[model samples]
Target: MANELTEYQQNLVSLVQSHELGDIIKPLIKEIHLFDSYISGTSHLKDRSVLEKIAVGDMLSLQREDNKFDSNAILILNEDGKKLGYVPEKDNIIFARLLDAGKLLKAKISSITQKGSFIQVGVGIYLVDL
Candidate 1:
């Protein structure tokens, strides 16, 4: 898959290797765009205030929620460890599989919209090579 890396990823790899702590630092290589969609069920979060504070470009974390009703459920959380919502079930099958396989993956807020009494969070999921 080395040949498949975009120019951006190549430059990132080079930049990381050139740093003083390059030997130990694991730079994230955005390998692929795994999914792009709104985080589902944000309206259900107890703390809606967190949604208003988050902005686009903020880094988010994903965790597999195996005990959830949906076996493929994945939880989306903010940098502060607050539960934001979830990776939509329809788009989480492959992501869950990748996470279960010990592959590195990450999400970043792509957009945020205020809808009446609730907030909608859009995220871009990417496969990362450390």
Candidate 2:
């Protein structure tokens, strides 16, 4: 059989691909309970990192490398989806900074602090002063 999809299937794919949040659902963000998301035309499923386990409804952003594959400097937001801190991967990321553009984070709040509020997410102690 040919690898094909009907127009309806295509439209469904588009809807899922675009991840447009509707009144009853949300976009496919990392916080979704399921981390089995897959990229089109590839077997690259979203990595089931410890980060992907964040509670549902939590807002998250990713940090990319050259606006592509995983890199560093990725940040995570609070439950309210506010910029709380960066991922850092495993080390300090000095460049390739892009928010709401190329950043894609996969972490969660490991701990909390005051001042403003920080998190032990993606990489680790990303503190953000209020």
Candidate 3:
């Protein structure tokens, strides 16, 4: 069969393709959970107290941070826009690519655990659509 798209479908694709990724409209669909992992470099946060206010199910923001150290760095922030940590280095490459493509991604607090002096904040990354 010949590959084809309806007029409306083709128009939608063209509309989306015309704008930058960040300018594209969010789809009217439920968010998709992509993966779960503990935030890295929590100990290095400027204000570790922000971790205490986090709770399960709280929505967080994912920002792509370009640095000389780790080019794939994705900064995780709290609802108040406070810095939490990062989506571990090994797992950040794909997330970076998705964010770079203008995909809206977020992280939800999944679990929080304390191990001695270390507080591990677990989060579930998601593809969010409005």
- Cα error, residue 99 of model 2, in Å, equals 12
Expressed as tens digits, the lDDT of each residue in 36-93 for candidate 2 is 2211111122332333345443444433323244544444444544444434344434
In model 1, pairs of residues that clash are none
Candidate 2: residue 84 Cα off by (Å): 0.8
What RMSD does each model have against the real structure? 7.6, 14.5, 8.3
**lDDT score of residue 7 within candidate 2:** 22
Highest-TM-score candidate: 3
Model 2 lDDT-worst window of ten: 36-45
Model 1 regions lying over 4 Å from their true place: 1-28
- Kindly provide the TM-score of model 1 when superposed on the true structure, using C-alpha atoms: 0.76
Selected candidate, larger TM-score, 2 vs 3: 3
Worst 10 residues of 3 by lDDT: 5-14
Candidate 2 similarity to native, TM-score: 0.27
Per-candidate clashes come to 0, 6, 0
